[model samples]
Target chain A: MTGVRRKSGSVPVSLATVAAAAEVSISTVSRIVNGQTHRASRETIERVRGAIETLGYRPNQLGRALKRGESRVVAMLTANLNNPVMATVASSAEAALRAAGYVMILCDTHDRPELQDEYLKAMRSQAVQGYILVTNVKSPGLAEFVARGEPAVFACRRNPYASGAFVGIDNVGAGADAADYLWSRGCREPAVLFPAQSSSTIEDRLAGFSMRLLELGGRCSKAEAPGLSHLDVGYEAARSLLDRASLPQGVMCLSDQIAYGAHRLFFERGLRVPDDCVMVSIDGSTLSSWLAPWLTSVRVPYHEFGRHIVDLLGEIWRGEASGERILPHAFQSDVSSDFE
Target chain B: MTGVRRKSGSVPVSLATVAAAAEVSISTVSRIVNGQTHRASRETIERVRGAIETLGYRPNQLGRALKRGESRVVAMLTANLNNPVMATVASSAEAALRAAGYVMILCDTHDRPELQDEYLKAMRSQAVQGYILVTNVKSPGLAEFVARGEPAVFACRRNPYASGAFVGIDNVGAGADAADYLWSRGCREPAVLFPAQSSSTIEDRLAGFSMRLLELGGRCSKAEAPGLSHLDVGYEAARSLLDRASLPQGVMCLSDQIAYGAHRLFFERGLRVPDDCVMVSIDGSTLSSWLAPWLTSVRVPYHEFGRHIVDLLGEIWRGEASGERILPHAFQSDVSSDFE
Candidate 1:
């Protein structure tokens, strides 16, 4: 058979030539090239291998794609593809998806609820058998999809709209844990930083921590009303906490993202973490992990979130009720845990 | 007709209910829900809209999944979902795909050539309509896939393994341009800081800069080859560059990532940017825009790359010759004729 001709052109090397060099059938050559296992015995594999060594017969993905219609593909959706936490999740998810014989199509919704809704419909048009939604989208549309038997799983944030099964840490319990830790470490007044109206997870966090602290008997006064998870909001919240002079001994941020912004402000104001003011956050992202002495964070088994989502989607595709599979969220404290 | 039960649980209103309330058909409700220009007359639209509003009608994507027998999901193969560059590309691509009624399932191959093979098979099983391989994978398997009519559009990174439609900047030219810029600024000697062989794009950058400077009657050398495209590499590379007794007056990097790294190292050592060692890099990410005064870079239009891939995929789906659509490498410099 004719092979791809070289641009410079002498006779282009062909599979036939490789077959001739290896003294095997063209079928055998093709088998080795295609990475087809089982049919070829060890001797054939060895002979073909020897032939491949001589002919440099590199099997390619482009050819396999033609026979298969769609090259390895899976549609993956997340809030921000760039978010280090999500990135880690995507990386791990890719590995798991590949292992399960799937290719992923990744999309970043920028955490936009409306955009998430649009993407849900758009995903339908592409015929994706499985999907993973990693956003704080509170759209009822998504819940409707899940109710209708769409194979999807939620990560990072849960869908308040109840579109599909969720595969995330117990945000509410995790936030309560964060609060308990901060308060236990000699913290009195505190704040829970998060966006206004993201998902039930955010509410869960707020309620978990505030209610826990309230139950623990700390007079809780919210210094800042909930705001977008912007660095500005974090900075301002921290600043106001300082300005009020009634500064709480600690502030519980909804996520590592919020804490990062708040940390900068805390640092610039000549306040040391855990010393002048104690700060705690969820999400063990690289940023918080690398923060000077490192910030205390709740490690939410982020990578596992990916694996669990894949497992859930697979089960769902097989018509199983995965129900609501929740991942374990743990608390981790390091050198940054100590407050002066 | 069953709607998502709100937290308030008001019998879960839906579009069907809205239609029932408005005494209209589901198509009319769908028209209102989709916001199509196929007008239902102002009063009709308003009545339908009012009923929908009162009913809290949210479009359920999963409801249509059974009828369509297609999830309309696309698959994406990404090299690095953690990288800001990759994330930006993902965001744009996701938006475009969604706009065209497609949801992307993203997988991060972790820049592993071996995993690319694993992912290829996965794509096939998913019945993905197309795949967007976003990698700098220069393995032979890539060529195999392209040869097979896989309906693939490369988002960024070209691999020697596959030859077909690709979208990326001229890294080599960009490097050469960096070299030229440094040379023109009275820098007799310049060294390029580059990532190692993990990425072909970095290799391309180094090759382009090294060859161009060598041809331009100057001496060029590598600063350091440590990690991937990052400020970390630049930092270590800067250490090596500084360790050299005869340091080059200007430093060029394969990417803004490396430049940032090197910048910090120089700053740490009491050297100022451009005053002692001018730094230039490629991939004008937003970090380059906001970090300090400014870092000279050859910026790639990331969003355009996303757009180009989608447009190409659309063409391929429609049986167009998208295989030949390749974007030329771009070079941006402070001394361009367009520069003010």
Candidate 2:
């Protein structure tokens, strides 16, 4: 049995108390308390208002019930925060989350599935209302866990089996797009190099590119570098490819990191990009623009994608209907023979 | 006059009831109920525990006075999440907090003091057991503002006034160490370049280097480029620094960004690092090692320093003495250099 002191005052009226008092949803209660009007019915509003008055429930998620009058914290769980792509996404996600009167709690799972599970458990333990998953690792528990009625969303990578909430570009389409672009650029025989990491994700991207290249009447050769080869795997693979008796007409790298390493090797070997060899890679990183005549690349919509994940999570928190969300990937194809 | 509901009945048991039943100090009753036990006498503990059991008085802050299984959540506030050093520190702090079974609510204030203030208010409102401030912009409210007296700790930046608890490297000493190493390597009459961002931080580092240079009988010239020149202002600064009719024999860039630009220029002009133009920087970014031949840099004590910040905050939360925590900076002098 629990009771509040009348002398000191009833336990500070909170959102939880008000939601319990009103026969309405959390988002509905939040909207009413925040003075937002739109979808709420007159009868529902009247009932909620009546409950608030009788219970003397003061809105707490605002600045008043709160001593300082603000609680705009947002918690984001990112896969591989060390990866520059995810880092870029997180940077933009914070920007958008802040613009929407929310702060972010960024958790980097280091692309470990078990660690991701631990973080999820921790988030639930803390009652974190929103979640953004940015990773390529496939975890069976993730989609189910987030889908089990929570304010959660996925970014950058999506689970094919789950439906109801995700915001990301078409990785497969992007891979195929790269292949098509390379083939169209007068390349007859193309070799694809992907670093071995996150089997599911690499497969998705590679499948997309492979499908397109085969359809475009171009021969496709695939190379998967052994061991951990994120970002720099392409360099080693490229060196080995060049040292081989014959070289493919063009090279397609999995990420900009691998491409960067390859570029260095080319420089070391007195070879220029797109001259002795035409190169293309995904992710328009900061270095891509600075490299000599610049790289022919497809820029991941990090800014938009990041915002989409956060915004979708907010929608879920606001009690939007459950479902899958796939954001479109904007392609940057301004790569000409524009090398100096 | 807050009270607890009775186990057998609905009637409330007040603090006075416990005090009367225990025949002890009302202050003692209050302290035990609130979970503070440092001042309570042993006999008083037995009396208060017995009284609380008899009267069934429940404490709010001290609610569940048992300490062993108590799980806490610490809200940590930081400015730039994208900055590698800050990112590493946060990662380490989160690990430490997690290992201790504490949830870390990380909020990025994004260099906005107003937002930082708002976040402080939010954390207070959330009733976070404690807070760890890792902000870029220093404010008066930072060192203090613990009205509820919830423990507060700082990381990275320090409270130079020596008022608040701090866990960071000795900025001045790190600067001096970098300078001493550079000069000992045949670098003479070195010029300094900084971000021109925060005068306090810039001056702190520059002063240490300048003081040491003067002590070494070498004249130090300084230049500050306005705006975000560390990244963009580099080329111009390098051009000006190098194009001068007479230039300093060596250069010390305040950051790897500045050093990268300067070195790029040096390369263009056919000058070599540590040979014709010895270059050194602080905040050892990954760019330092990945660059060809690497860069001479002063690596901030990230691992050790990060661990200390979390440990200090833990100590503060545990009701230990709260004071300034001056951490030592580990200097990595082997920053890829060739000296006589």
Candidate 3:
């Protein structure tokens, strides 16, 4: 430990100190230490090896990863962690990534484009190997990152502008299923409640629901409002719908949050579910079962998202082309007759 | 990019290549690049500076941070991100840390001591500057890390074996408030439902609740069940209570998730809140208002936790001693007379 000075409680011996002790270049020391001894002479390798042992120089894993232009770190940029749907997706992905020997850095964007951009830049500077974006807002930084062929997988909500790896349920199919269920329940006219800030998931669900409702010879009306949270959006949208006309026989909520907001408004108006208006929504989260009326909604296979997204990222890392993975969805209800 | 060979699409120029081109030690190049040039002569600094420009070497922030034995990264170990309470704490803390110019790496320990240990080791290797632990499980690794004078702040759940900084509501006081509310509702016989796996939060709340109940000349019974999620714990505990004896006139759920599960069980048993039995619970999350019959709860100031925890971490970083910070909580109910 001649060249490397160790204080009572100080930082560990760095590579610079090892190089200095071995009287060789840092690259030579690093190559020898990392087991790339063929690049250096035998005498130099032995000297560096001896110096490493004498100084107890442990290679920093993060520093090594930086030098190799790769890391076992994946960053997940979630729009809203407080949203149960997003939380489930993030937690599941984290577990899968951890199992695959990758540490996940979760960043909550709060559905703000600026925050998403900031996190993307910050994670890039940290040399994250991949990204799992639950992005709803359009972010230029994300689009550029994906365009550069970086390993990025869109979960739950896909970026409309960029064509990259995506893993989620078929939103249109889920919406069509909701429409069919509501129609089979002897409801003709139905109202769909959604947030004003549109996303691919919302637009596709709206398209599928309206198309299927028209095919069933039933008219569908949409109500939307601009709000910070989905709950507020649903509450305001429901208020608008109630203010204009009478309650429809059936209703479709774009999300579980939206459904809760609308249900609260309905409860305030003394309108009961299945008796006054049968309601159907997407996102079969735990909230559906936790609610009193037991919301009949289309269930997204969120638990499977982690494995699928991680597997897709593995493919991307192997120079595979972009792909879309759509998991299966089913209609769930404690009372089956609610849809009959 | 004269000294550096830039392919069509290849890795960026690293510090090693710059050092090689400068014909100086990597430490010299790093020092000059990081504006720590006092250690090197002016001529050597000039050579390294010229090489850096010619090689187009952009320093990796993470690599620099590693060399300095510090990082602007904080790792948060959450018990269960699927739990809305944990989600709120994590998301709020993320936002606060981000505003303070720090990146947060969130890991869901899922209430497993082994997982907590794994994350603690993994984060340590990553050279995270601090930790925010929402840990419930007793982890030996965590205790050792804390004992070694690491910067860690416990959120919501405090570790029984370690003395460290904590930022959360006073669970004992909140529990006493719940008991007082139940007593005011004229319910003499009260039942408290909690999870089988114990944590400081649960233990403190139960202690406060029972102590205050006895002071009020009322008796309290406890129900517990072993389950993976708090919801299942409440559901199974309620079933056990129902099968063994008659339903109590008042029930206290340890958390909002527990309340939802117990309320579902009550609904299934043809009982109603505030009518057949009065109910009170802690964790006044969004779930409280989302439920059909608005749950009377003690609202933990979750939104304030992020700021306080981040600020406390700042104090620890500045050589401040370990301190405990307890936030305030209040009783929330849409109908005040529900307690009266």
Candidate No. with top TM-score: 3
For this target, which candidate reaches the highest lDDT against the unseen true structure?
3
Clashes of 2: 10
lDDT of 2 by residue, A1-340 (tens): 3584222102445666777778777778778877886779998888888887887565433233223312355567776555667767787887787678665766777677787777776655444446777753656556546445545666666653465567766678878878877888888788888876654456777888888888888877766665343546766777677777366778888777777667766766777678777788777665444322335776776767666766676666555664555555544545322212
Candidate 1, residue B196: Cα displacement in angstroms equals: 1.9
Give one digit per residue, the lDDT tens place, for model 2 in B1-340: 4595221112335667788898876778888866788888888988899878766455421122122213265777776665556666777777777677666767777767677776776654455566777774655445335433446677766543345567766678777877897788867788887765563456677888888888888877776665443544454577776666455667888766677666766666777776776777777764344343346777765655556777777666565675655556544545332111
Tens-digit lDDT string for candidate 3 (B1-340): 5787332123556788988998987777877887997799989988888887776566676776866777788999998888888889998999999999888888988889899888887887777888898885877877766656667888898866766789988899999999999999998989999999999999999999999999999998889988758888878889888888898989999988888888878888888887988889998876567564557888888978999999989988887775889988987646323222
TM-score of chain A of each: 0.74, 0.71, 0.83
Cα lDDT of model 1 by residue, A140-228, tens digit: 66666656655567776675555456777777788788888887888877766665545666677878888888888875555453544
Q: TM-scores, in order shown?
A: 0.65, 0.71, 0.86
Please give the lDDT score at residue A238 for candidate 3: 92
Interface RMSD per candidate: 9.9, 10.6, 3.6
Clashes of 3: 0
DockQ of each: 0.16, 0.10, 0.38
- Rank list by TM-score: 3, 2, 1
> Which runs of model 3 end up more than 4 angstroms from their true locations?
A1-59, A333-340, B1-59, B333-340
